[model samples]
Target: MSDYLPSIYTKFLAQFPEVAEAQGAVAQAVRERTPFDERTDRLLKLAMAIGAQAQGAVKSNVRKALQAGAGLDEVRAVALGAITTCGFPTAIAALGWIEEVAEAP
Candidate 1:
């Protein structure tokens, strides 16, 4: 049992002490598998961030994406994919995130 599960924020952390443990277990269970490269995952997450207009998360994930193996062009394509699913604003935002990461040291 660790601490801090996303679900806990909306749930019984105060009422049930054991809920914290359970939530941590759930998070850990989901986190244990490193099924894909982290950078690739970050790139995908960045696209999600764009769709949600979560600029901070997008910016952070873009850096992680570049660190993983995501190319600028690849990131752009991902953004384009988001356009079909999420709309143009999301796609453009993702592109901006990619560009920001590309410019970073």
Candidate 2:
């Protein structure tokens, strides 16, 4: 796991190992079903999170995107680009979520 991931997330995965394994398998299955490369897939997911105005998902996806080698600028662009379809408030809120992960140690 990336160092930027929140401790709560890691602890939850640890505390619920079986569920975490299941979720990991599901994530791998989804990745296998995708034609997009890892970086592209992660970026698209981040964009979707932004559009959905899901703060936690935004943070998670931002961390995943960066772990998959996306630049912070690319992540920010995805959130900001959501403004057109998702509106300013949603995108702005998502941007904050992205920053929370992107700027983390």
Candidate 3:
């Protein structure tokens, strides 16, 4: 666990020990896949997390997206596609969350 794990995440980890293992597998798989792009599958899934109002997943994916070199513009474009696919409200809310994560250093 790097400094990237925010306090919010640490608080949750007290209850979900499995999160670490699951995250490791997901990270490895994601790293083995195509590079981050608005057209990529991971981008679509990130949008879905937003649509589902999954805060934990959204935070994790957004961090992963950034680590995978997804720029804010690329992410916003993905969110636009999400608006089309997952509907307006879900997409907008997710966009907000993604922006928060992407802006972080």
Please report the candidate that would top TM-score against the real structure.
Answer: 2
The estimated TM-scores of all candidates read 0.62, 0.84, 0.64
lDDT string, candidate 1, 1-105, tens digits: 112233544466667869778888995676567575666667667777878888666666666666677776777777788888988877787787667667755
**Clashing residue pair totals per candidate (backbone < 3 A):** 0, 0, 0
RMSD of each: 7.3, 2.1, 4.3
Evaluate model 3: give its lDDT. Answer: 0.71
lDDT (10s digit) by residue, model 2, range 27-71:
999999999999999999988878777777888888888888999
Estimate, for each residue in 1-105, the C-alpha lDDT of model 3 and write its tens digit: 122876776777777779867987896788677565633555666777877878767767777666666666777777678777778987788778777776666
Error of 1 at 81 (Å): 0.9
lDDT of 2 at 88: 93
Which of 2 and 3 is the better model by lDDT?
2
| Residue pairs whose backbone atoms clash in candidate 1 | none
Off by over 4 Å in 2: none
Clashing pairs in 2: none
Least accurate 10 contiguous residues by lDDT in model 3: 34-43
